[model samples]
Target chain A: MIDLSDLSKSFGGTPALTSTRLKIAPGELVCLLGPSGCGKSTLLRLISGLIPPDTGRILLDGQDMTQTPANRRPTAMVFQSHALWPHMTVARNVGFGLRVRGLPRSEIAAKTEAALEMVGLRGFDRRLPSELSGGQAQRVALARCLVVAPKVLLMDEPFSALDAHLRKSLREELKALQRRLGLTTIFVTHDQEEAMELADRIVVMKKGAIEQEDTPSGLYACPATLSVAQFIGQMNVTLATARDGCVAWGGRRIEMPVSGDLTLACRPEDLLPDPQGVPAEVIRITDLGPLLRVALMTPQGEALTWLTPRAAAPLPGARIRLWPRALHVFRGETLLETIQPQRLTLEEDA
Target chain B: MRRFPLGGLTLLTAMVLAMLGPVVTVVLWAFAVKWRYPQILPTEWGLKFWAEVLSRQTITGPVLTSLALASVATTAAALICWPAAFAFARLRFPGRQLLLFSFIAAQAVPKFALFLSIAVIFLQLGLVGTFPGVALVQGLSAMLVMIWIPTAAFRAIPPALEEAAFDLGASRLRVFLAVTLPQAMPALAASYVLAFVAVLFEVDSGLLIGAPKVTTMPLTLMTLSAQVVVQDAAVLCVMIWLPCFVLLLLTRRFMTSRGIAEGLGA
Candidate 1:
């Protein structure tokens, strides 16, 4: 288990991480998801002991490892660029840690071969990093880190350099590899889709603080803030005056159990075309193979997007109505309200 | 319509002739037994001057002494420049620019002005008339140029390589030894060759501080040329040129195989 307590770091008097606390269970794959420059890499570096925190205590397996150097720590990092030593051969690069630990040459050779095979780089022992393709070099880098058998593996956008197809393939490969190794991993990425796909639990970050931390599905289905909803996926929010279990928007009053200046949010897929629903005009239609994205403008000029089957094509100037099962409501900038699916049905019945 | 009228083939021929002209002249003169100033070519050619110069103890000892001094000085300069170059390339500190500029500035100043003061210092230290003092002076003079070339080479290495080494559980020293130094080998070789050539021709300090006892090949050649006629001086100059010729040949082979010239822009 890895634990961070009141972790804070500053660079030249500007704070990067501010009293952040986190815990990862053994064999957990937790991803730190945030925008660029949001201190996700900084947190990973602090855990790896590449840099020390100005004020914090890092505990690994109940032992304080705050003062330990990076090489001494039982943590390894796969950098975004996959920083492989270009001078050494593949086998030598993989066996570097063993050599540093003064292991016998024969033993290092055996272990290096095994590690190479594990990363699917067998028979590439003699090739230098420069001779390998980017993906091959990345695999060599992964082999180098894994051969050390580190307790915690930290990856900072390890697949960001690959093409979309390769990135998908590598993500699955990495997930399976992590499971087989049973090593606790902290993955950092600015890409939300990648975070949702890979992480058992995602920690959403904004402005150097954790906005929310939950299972990927939970964070996607029930975002706690406007920023979280906005960041995770495309969300349409409508301003509504909420009072007395009723929300008013676009000259139509809907049943909602929220008070104050609330905002309504519904996923595009959940908003379906219905004969008896809120009146809207299709301002634009975008066909996206399996799903069609229809941009709707209410009579009051409020805009919302709804996903429908491509077969059910809606003309650009067509009039329509949309009834989404679930909706989220927020007051001001905070997610202060949630409207369950039954409320929408009750409003339809009334 | 063209920039210069010298065609490529003409330029190539001219460059080759210019390089070979002085070397062929020296070799021919060293073999010639007798030659007058008005003569375009030698009347007689023999090994008589070569034998005479080789047989003489005076010419031979100074030649040996100069070789020993240059070898020791070049080796010492390489050693001193390696770490200094590494530091200048990698680290950030106060006065770094100033320190580097001071090294370059030392190269620009006339050596004669410093030679008088260096001689006094060497006399006070009782290091005058010694080979070590002369070699030390030569090494110090060549240190800046040697270090600057390799420093630029070391700086060209990607910082990612060293960081990668450290990430893979290598210590800082191990990273330099395993990764950094190998990449800088071509530059290091170039620096050594340049330093060797610089030390070989170093005569000002050797003449000033080394006076009567510590005689280098250049100084010996100077005295022999003055006492004897121009032909004898040219013969001595030819004799002196032999070691430099061997060094140049060896360095050419080394540089070509290692691609040091292309790598370091030599």
Candidate 2:
């Protein structure tokens, strides 16, 4: 239950963040995903009151906290570096916020114990920060935030510091913890897979602007723009000229709404090897664990990737036919429409 | 308990002894009343200078004055430096590098030249021959070290730690006190002690402004050594650092980091 309105920020005279309006529902985990310098972290900092936004308002439960300092805010943040006070013991680290608030020692200790238990770090209270592993440190940071019972939790790439295996386990634990507590959380990360795995809604950001905000599958199935589709998955994007309510590509014509010259893209799974379809030349086949990916060049020299089963993978340089089950068409980065399987027609190879 | 490198250990022992040779000489030379040129050790030792240094001697008042001034300078400079050091190391602002460079640039000025100008200024301000005036100048000279050490110490702490403290509802002051300062305690302690000793070593500024009324240890050591009063100078030197050795031991725990910041892939 956080709402940001008309937020825009500039760093050293260059626009670093721009937001129009965003509403995160109670207990909803929203992920801010983008490349580096995309203003995802800037947005988080603005919300956390670490930095005041140049223009905008942050509403927590309908109270404007835009001008409030971080200490006055009801939100807490878990840093990517874990940020556990190295000199402090785990219990002391978790209790730091409470201590700052002037809470009683007994109460702080009790809450810290409960929080650590929730993160499965029950016996680590007496250990210093330097004594724990990367994952443990992160859990301590989580417990520290959770102990405060923040209205909203902010995490900036909190799992990026760990090994892949540790990251996966920690991410699952974090997600589970958030779900159990029903915490309204804003997590920032550049990892698409992490966003998909953790977020109830993913806010795809580009150049300080929100590109698309949708559920993971919703975004993957129907991206609002070319950038969203390109960012989310392995895709086969090709530029096509739309003419007279028909699509022209690779010396082939297909029935479709003629908007304008546009770019077309689809997931690798969208392209299916089929009989009774235009033939294409397979350039290479990669043996991915779950699916074998076949790379093919259309007659017009556009390369497309098709994911076939490992058992059904075609050889490299093989002449094959591919038909699309669904494909997205975009006009200058904006999504024009997604042409479903029923609307597509395969043309013969030149 | 572990396997010892015998040859390496012998070399290390010789190096340590060689390093302590001058210090031993200073101690022995302070007590020696009769010693010739080729003697390896003092043949006859006397306690005349030691008694004089302990009992109202020219160096007595200087020693006390130096300790008091150094204490004040170190405390004041430490208080001033840590916050500035944190800002210098952490905050990004316009002309940050330039500002830090100005502080370091002050260190490049020779002590005598800087003291000459400072003494003239202090005299006009009616602060000449005053303890506060002398201590203030000592603080300015010591501040270069004060800023540099804690800046490094503060830099070693991840900003995320301070941010995390703030994100969890700790104010900026609370963040510095609770998170940054505790983590940087060792550096702060090291800087404070080094600054104190640095003040004790300063002669030009103290002599220029504090003489004829205030006599700090360095002024006495400087004049004594100039007059070839090596024994008394050596005695004064022992008095200054011997007590500090205890102080250092007491604060030694603060100098070492609390068991290495774990889980940071170290």
Candidate 3:
């Protein structure tokens, strides 16, 4: 387990990471998910002892490891670029840490082979990093860190180097390996789907600070902030007046919190065509392989998107009534209420 | 310039040949037994002067001295430059670019001018005509190379490779030895060759700093060229060019591993 207490860092008088607190469990895979310059990499570097934190205490397995050098700590990182020593062969790269520990040659040799085997590269011991394909080299890099049997594994966008298909397969393969090893891992990536697929919990970071931290589904369904709602997925938010735990927008009322300056936010998937709902003119329906992304303009001139079956979407310029199955109400950045479909049914009954 | 497709190519070839012109002249001079200033080619050629230069103990001493001094200078410069280059490449300082520029500028300034000014101190310290002093003086002329080329080479090494080594629990020293140094090897090799060749061919520093007592190969060749027998200087030139020719042949394989170049660009 690692406890980051009040961890903050600044580069050139500009804050890279704000005072942040987080607890990572022993065997949990947590992804620091964010776009570029969001301090995800900064936090990882601080934890790995690559850079000194401006202020913080990092407690690793109940020890104050903030001052400990990266070498002394039972932690290892697989770099984003896979950073394999260009000169060393696959076996030697895997055995590097053991060699540093001054382990006997035989032991290092045996373990290196085992590590190569573990990463499914048993015959790749003699190959230099340049000889390996992108996927092969990535495995070798993984084997290199895993050979040391580190307590925590930090991966910084390891799959970002590969093509789409390779990225997906390697992602699954790495996820399986992480589970099998039962290692506490901190994976960093900007790709939301990759985070959702791999991480047990995703920490959404923005502007050097975490916006929200939760399970993928939880974050998707219950985004606490307007940015979180918009960042997590395609969310359509419209200005609405809240009254008596309900929001009035587009001639229809959402049963939610009462506020003067509340905004109704709903994911593209949550918006569905209904006979008795707010009116909209379908602008275009784009085929998105699994679903058609329906583009619409409401009577109030609010642009909206809804993912529906190709057959379900009305043709362009056709009028359709739509209902938000769930509406997340946010006043400024704060989420006020989550009005479900039952509230709409209850409002209909009333 | 781009109006004609082959115009740029012709210009580039002319520039390359212009640079190689003196080198080609030296090679031709090495074989020329009887060549006058008015004539373009030598009237005659023979290996007789080669045997005479090789047989002479006076000529061989400076040849050996030149070899020894170049080796010592190369080693010393490498020791000084490795960490210096690493620091300049990896670390951030207020005046890094300025300092790098100043050092690189050291290469352009003639060493004879610098040596002349520093000779007073060397004379006072009783190191003026000594082998160590001469070699050390020769090293200063090539200091920019010892720092600059390797600095570029080490800079070409990705910082991530070192970080990965550290992440795997290797100490700073181990990272330098096992990871960083190896990555910079090709560049270092190329730089070492350059430094060695630079020291070997240095002319004025030996006369300015190591005059009277010490004799270097370039100095010996200079004196040989001043002699009555023109063929003797030609033979000495061949002797000087031979080893460097072999070194150049070996250089291609080392330079082909452009890992450092790619790393720096990245």
Candidate 4:
């Protein structure tokens, strides 16, 4: 368990993270997800005691660790760069923390070997960091942190340096490992897909402030703000006027579940081809293997994207009737609610 | 490859002779028992001057003095410069660049002029003719090498490694000894050997600050050469050159794999 209360940090008079507050439950894997310079890494450093917060308190299970130095805190960090000591062989690198703790040499060796085995690197104890591949080096870094048996783990974009295929496999392995160990983790990353795949709860940050925090599905289904919606996945947003529970768009009036002028957004997959819906010109088509994406432009010049099975995809320049299967209504920047469209049996009058 | 590159080979041979000729001549002189004009080589070779050097205090005392001075000065410089080098490499403070440049600029001014001025200061401080005075001057001359190379080596270590050590519960000093120092050891050792050799052979500071009281090997060799004592000078030259050559070879053996040049360049 961890609690960060009103934590703020600044570098050279520039605020990296503002007065931020977060609490994580025990054995929960929380992700700090954001674009670069959004203060995700700063938050992780504040928690790890690598950098002192400008003003706040950090509590681990009700113990105030705000004044504790990194070495004195019951936390470990896996850096994005791996950070294994180049001069030490893999065994020494993994056993360094135990050695620092003044553990017996035989015990240190046994624990180090077990930790390496946990990371699936059993026979790599004698290899220097330079001798291992990128992924192996990362596993050794992980083993080093795990050997210390800290109360919490802090990983700052640990897999960002790997190739895409390697990153995915490592991400899955890390998630499985964290679940098995039941380790409380604070993972910082700019990768949305990684956060979606690995986080129990994703805390989306923007401009050094928490934008939204929710489960991966909750974030995708109902984003708190327009930016959160845009960040989590592809969103098709357009403005429309709502009056008396009816919405007007693209020279056609459609019945709505909500009233008042609002910005509307829908997922591409949620926009279905309907007989009695707004007409748009298909301007481009994208092949996505199993699915095809149709980019359409309304007569009013509003752009919309629709995903359909490749076999049912309309050709470019074709006119298609588009209807929202579900609509997310927003007033300014905040999402109001999601509405399911009712099937209409009206005849086409165009 | 086809022609055996005779032209290149001839040029290389000339360069090697140019470099080794004086050294070979001095080594022969140190062992020559009887040689005169028009002799292509030493007519008779023996250890006569070696025996003379071993027996005479003029040679033996300077050798001991030189070794002691080099050890003291190099240790003192390393102790003073190491923390300064780490600060230069890691910390951001006002006037850091200016301070680092001052260390380099101190080496650029002609040593004789600088030592002359320092000697004046030493006289006022009542430090002249003292071993500490000589050691201080030698340490000052060695600072550029001591600070620059180690600073570069320290800078080359990823800061994340230190942070990781801290995250794994290593105290600052523990992290330094276990991680930072070992990684930078090769470059640091190379610089130490180089600084020791440079101080051992230093003549200007010795003449200005240590003329009568502190007689180093180079100062003695300078005296022998001025007096035209060829065999004694040659013997002293070989003695001075031997430690430097041996230490350099040892340093090279270790540094070849560690990339000390990369550390310095970094």
Best-fitting candidate, scored by DockQ: 2
lDDT of 4 at B263: 41
Give the alpha carbon lDDT tens digit for every residue of B1-266 in model 2. 98889999999999999999888888897888877889988788999888877886677877888899999988888888878998889888999899888987889989889988988898899888999999999999889888988888889877787888888877777776676666787777878887888788888767788876888888788777787667877887787768877767756863554443332211
Model 1 ranges off by over 4 Å? A237-264, A276-289, A292-306, A315-324, A340-350, B1-60, B123-129, B153-160, B218-266
Model 4 DockQ, alpha carbons vs. true complex: 0.46
Model 3 chain B is weakest, by summed lDDT over 10 consecutive residues, at B257-266
Candidate 4 docking quality: incorrect, acceptable, medium or high: acceptable
Among all candidates shown, the one with the greatest lDDT: 4
lDDT of 1 by residue, A136-180 (tens): 888888898898899999898888998888888888888999999
TM-score of each predicted structure versus truth: 0.82, 0.88, 0.89, 0.89
Report the poorest 10 consecutive residues by lDDT, candidate 4 chain A: A341-350
lDDT of 3 at A54: 89
The better candidate by lDDT, 3 or 4, is 4
Candidate 4 ranges with C-alpha deviation above 4 Å: A239-251, A254-262, A281-284, A316-319, A341-350, B1-49, B226-232, B254-266
Checking candidate 2 for backbone clashes, the offending pairs are A130-B262
Better of 2 and 3 by TM-score: 3
Poorly placed runs, candidate 2 (over 4 Å): A341-350, B1-18, B31-37, B43-49, B79-99, B120-130, B151-157, B222-231, B246-252, B255-266
State the fnat of candidate 2 relative to the true structure: 0.89
The best candidate by TM-score is 3
